[model samples]
Target: MKIRISWQGKEVEIESGSPGAVLVEAFGWKDPRPIAIRLGGELLDLHSPLNREGEVEPVFPEDPEALPVLRHTAAHVLAQAVKELFPEARLGIGPATEEGFYYDFEVPRPFTEEDLEAIEKKMKQIVKRCYPLRREELSKEEAERLFSERGETYKVELIREIPEDRVSVYRQGDFVDLCRGPHLPHTGMVKAFKLLSVAGAYWRGDERNPQLQRIYGTAFFDKEALKAYLERLEEAKRRDHRKLGRELELFSIEEEVGPGLILWHPKGAIVRKEIEDFWREEHLRRGYQLVYTPHIALRDLWKVSGHLDFYAENMFAPMEIDERAYQLKPMNCPFHILIYKSRKRSYREFPIRYCELGTVYRYERSGVLHGLLRVRGFTQDDAHIFCREDQLEEEIFRVLDLVVYFLSVFGFEEYQIYLSTRPEKYVGSEEIWEKAEGALAAALEKKGLSYEIDPGEGVFYGPKIDLKIRDVLGRFWQCSTIQVDFNIPERFDLSYIGPDNRPHRPIMIHRALLGSLERFFGVLIEHYAGAFPVWLAPVQAVVLTVADRHLPFAEEVQRELSRAGIRAELDARGERLGFKIREAQVKKIPYMVIIGDKEVEGRRLTVRTRKGENLELGLEEFCARVRREIAEKIVF
Candidate 1:
């Protein structure tokens, strides 16, 4: 039968009995190399047999869909290489991730840097062989027997866990793995690959399971792309907030202070203050009323709100005070709900938007703690809106507008938006679900924003819209989330008397434009490579003395800049002027003002930017420029 393969604005017809065969033929063409094939919106391996006619699109390697495929194939290659090098190594699971791929193995010894190099060498050889990947099906019993005979206990265990009577496995040369695969035609397709590192991971991400050595690797379709990716990785490492935070004396996570808990130094606190000030100004301008809540609430409050039952695991262990259990808040929703229920409201006062930069605690797994990104205690820029059913769409539209405005101000213009509908086990009646989902959809449409609908991906209580902003390196971070909750209002028995003289439940919309302040700050640090915009920079300006004679002038200039609301500091560390300038550059300060005898005599200052450009200006002129840049939030 003839099958059509479409890719990169071109289509070709080939004779094949399976989709995989068609993909192999299409990939043979030089123009369509490094393509991802999908049949009727379902991704298929090049080895998958076609049972019916369907539309196919070949996604390029750079495409979002193709990244997973490339990384997955790289994982398979890594597994094959490990097996070839260590005959006794047993495979657990090898899956592709957002950054790359990792394969877990149960080996007698953990893999080291040398082992990674040797395995990489073996992988290159395997790729050169260009062995064809073939898929086969067998009965469950037969599959278990085959793997058991080969001493592959992990594979046999996995096969035993399969519920079906029959199972599929893929083979390349002598290496076989039980998988539901649409793999590449041959190993040689993985041309540019590198083994990144080795780490210990649980058998299936469960701490209770046996620890397995996981080898992480990444791959690309071509050498140039691989080089670019490596360069980006290096840049990201250099900009990592953990490193920058420590070197800049911003924050610290100490063993004595406990893990996943940040101790913000003066510098970090100053940055936080700036962020909070800006956030408050923007929220107020948007007509949001700010409120404060306690760090701990009675367990009964959470029980009534359904969090004690639903979110108990993530919550901190309860503490007993005055013979009653009180728990550190894991979320600000219930508190906000109680506040809404505190007083009688009316339809005329509908759409009450309340916001808070509330701090909460969670029991994060120890292994997953990474700087400020995943923390045990952090503040969320949380807000909740109580509105009538008729006002739901407008409230959501306003939140969407606020999200876009805030993200754009941070230089995140690109976004990936997802509108998630009800899950199968969700709360509320079907009618309520329909109304909530429709409101979210209407808001998106009203704003002229395109969003992907995620079927059955919502929380158990409500549907939601999640927004991911694209960073400079093309990585997306989930920042903004807006959820419509019909359950919370019902659980809390919240109502507002309408104009019709009837008490009606108000719709609750929960939103966090920046998600968690800590995680957002981490992303922001990496997004701008620690050289934040003028307004957001922790230290906007640094004043340096060219010599001892210029010390007084430098101090005066620093005071003036500080008075003008620029975060300025004076360098009096007895260091050379060149050294001070370099220190400012390393600290990522936007501006550096150098004071010298020439400038002091002329009652002027020498301005040096982070980019190393120097200009001579009067003290007043420099202060005015700095003030304007900060006020305007200029990128420079």
Candidate 2:
């Protein structure tokens, strides 16, 4: 078979009998260098035989899919280096991530920084060998026997789990791995790579399984590209929320309190209170009635909502209470449903909006718990709307409006949206599912928002729209979601009187604009690098004294600022004034008010902005300006 292909902007005819290497040479594709070939919507290494009779295009290093492919090959090289140095080690999975790749190995001891350096040196040596990555397929039994003979227990276990009769493997020199195809042609192509760090990981992410040492690394086609990524990694390390949280006295996770449970220090609590106050005000202004729910409920409630059937594994175990079973609440929707059904409703109450900052608990693995991003107990900015079908789109649009407003105020203007369709295990009927999906799509269209289709990613109950916001560092964080549920209303038989004087089921909408407050706060800390704006700053201003003579005036200034509702601190210690100012700067205070001899004599206030701008003002003027900034909720 023959097919037309494009290479270097030239159209040529090629036969399927030839391998990709022939095409690469025929087109002189070495300038940008085609590491892989794309044909029939599949990527193949340059040495692989091309069997597709279709238009083919060489995948250049600059293509979108090139980095991941390159990084996966780098992981293979890393594994090869490990084998060369430590022949007794057994390998685990090594997959490419968005930023890099990692490989796990079962070893007697954990790796050290020195080991990483040695592995890097060994990897460079193997790259010079230029061993071709040959792909092979064997029967399941044969694959298991091969790995078993090599003492690769992990590979044998994985091979047995494969339902396919045959399994694919890749080989480079003497190193072989159970993997799919689409690897680099050879090891010499491995360049511009770095071995990042090492950590312990369980087999298949299960804690009960044997733990393996995981090494993470990244690669780029060119040195300059790799340099830019390393710089970004450095910036990310500096902005890591965990480090900022402790240094700024914002929050912490204690050994006694348990992992994934954030204990907000005094300063952190102040910031949280400010965020919650704004959330409450906006929710109330949007016609949402605030409500509360208990932290624990009867076990029967979850069974009725289908959480037990589909989400039991993620839920905590139940406890005995008064000869009955009680479970911690993993969600707030069921409680809101019960609240709606507490009384009879009329058509006049067609649209019911209930919002809650309800704290819920779920069982999260200790290994996966991040600082404040992933926690077992956290408060959700959850709201549910019960309305007629006609009002569905409008309610969805309104929720989107609120979501955009909140994000914009928080200085997050870049975001990605996704429309998720029903899952295979969804509760609703096919027709209802389609209708719900269409309704969400229509709402997105009406809002003039573009979203990608995330197939089969919706909740087990319904379709949803998820908004992931991009931080200042260009990192994406999942923050908000809106879901259209038909199952909950049907399960609870929620009804309202219609114009025809008959009971009509109202459609339910579940929305969480901020997902979890804890996670959002963590994102905010990183986004602003722990220098919260004046409105959210725990100590918006601090009054500093230049000398002992200014102590009386400093007390007066601090009292004045505090009376005007400014979160201020007075640094009247005998320490040097420069030291006080430096400490305040480290604390990330937005403004520093100087009470010096000149200011005291003039009965005036001298303010130094966080950015180092100074201004002189009367007592009333300073208070007015501070209040205005707070009222405006200005984002720095």
Return the TM-score for each candidate structure.
0.93, 0.96
lDDT, candidate 1, 1-636, per-residue tens = 776666555666766555455564654644656444677888877677665555676656666787677777778889999999999998898888877889999999889889989999999999999987787889999999999988888888889889999998889899988888767778888889888889888876677888899888888878898899899999889989999889887889999989999999887787788788989999999889999999998888888888878888788899999999999999898988878888999899978999999999999877678998999999999999999888888999999999998888789889999999999898899998999999999999999999999999999989999999999989899999999988888888999998998998898999999998889988988888888888887888888887787888778888888888788888877888788888889988888887888888888877888887888888788888878887877753
Question: Which residue pairs overlap in candidate 1's backbone?
Answer: 18-50, 19-50, 20-46, 45-182
lDDT of every predicted structure (CA atoms): 0.86, 0.90
For model 1 the TM-score comes to 0.93
Worst 10 residues of 1 by lDDT: 27-36
lDDT of 2 by residue, 1-636 (tens): 786666446766778656688787777778777889887778887756666566577887888988888898999999999988999999999998988999999999999999999999999999999999987779999899999999999999999999999998899999999987678888898889999999998899889998899999999988998999899899888889899999998999999988878899999999999989999999999899999999999999999998998899889999999999999999999999999999988878868999999999989988789999999989999999999988888899999999999998889988899999988787868987888888889888988889999999999878999999999878899999999988888888899989999999899999999899999999999999899988899999999998899999889889989999999898888898789888998888999998998999999999988898989999889999999989998998
Measured with C-alpha atoms, the lDDT of residue 140 in candidate 2 is 97
lDDT of 2 at 495: 95
Among all candidates shown, the one with the greatest TM-score: 2
- TM-score (C-alpha, index-matched) for candidate 2: 0.96
